[model samples]
Target: MRNALLAISLIAVFAFFLYVAVNPGDFGGNTGDHLIFGEPKYSDMDDYFIHNGQNQTGANNIVTSIVFDYRGFDTLGEASVLFTAVLGVGVALRLLRRDKNDE
Candidate 1:
């Protein structure tokens, strides 16, 4: 019964996502912009990055320039979080092994 309920719940969640993807405007999407999938949204920030990211960051790759220069602190925080998670997992594994050996 639990497995059946889980299956039904998963199916319902997937259907909800599918509905949202098909009719995004129904769920707080901008009705004024009729751009479909794969269409680019032109913004001043995007224009600035495309034109001046290389000059500002001195990086050949625009993506690298944006990640390392524009969002450096945000990237650093992400790396810190990932490092913490890895350290936690290592500590947990060591504790588990020590406990098993103590038995």
Candidate 2:
């Protein structure tokens, strides 16, 4: 229970960083009309698909390709960041790497 709370708190801190990512000009005090987060408006590329045994490229599924291949570097970075955070928590809580020779 305590560990879950700690994890949630850490994630909240990271999510709050989005304040810096979203410009004030983007929101402009209009709070009720649209979403504040995510892909900025769900572009067309998000809905692309395939045909008989081959996928179409004229519509050029940039978003799909990015999430799967070209942007995989970023994905790997995100995974590493999560791993680092969990490892940090484990160390902080003394859940791992304890010195066996110590009292």
Candidate 3:
């Protein structure tokens, strides 16, 4: 019953997002409303990154350039966190299995 409810909830959420993407104006109440959610009013920063990211970072992929060059430290921290979590999980499971075998 819980799984069924979760599946139904997931489907409803996906359908809502699909409807919003297909008919954004319906959710916005206007075709060009920019108060909360609509087309971006300012894209100068994004434009600059796209145009100069390759040359500035010497990376052919703009996304990669931004992630590894502009936000290298942030990405490194996230990777470190993920590695630590996986290591912890592995150690904990190994100790648990060892305890079960000894008992």
Task: List lDDT for all candidates, in order.
Answer: 0.89, 0.63, 0.87
Clashing pairs in 2: none
For each candidate, give its TM-score against the true structure: 0.63, 0.37, 0.59
- The residue pairs found clashing in candidate 1 are none
Tens-digit lDDT string for candidate 1 (1-103): 9679989999999999999898766443444665445456778999899999999999999999999999999999999999999999999999989988999
Model 2 scores what on Cα lDDT?
0.63
lDDT of 3 by residue, 1-103 (tens): 9679989999999999999898766553445535445555766888999999988999999889989999999999999999999999999999989988999
Residue 27, candidate 1: Cα error in Å is 11
User: What is the C-alpha local distance difference test score of candidate 3?
Assistant: 0.87
Say which candidate scores most in lDDT. Answer: 1
The residue-level lDDT of candidate 3 at 95 comes to: 94
- Number of the predicted model whose TM-score against the real structure is largest: 1
lDDT of 2 by residue, 1-103 (tens): 9789989999998877776666445643445756665336655554533331124333355556555565678998999999999999988668434653354
Error of 2 at 13 (Å): 8.8
Q: Provide the clashing-pair count of each candidate structure.
A: 0, 0, 0
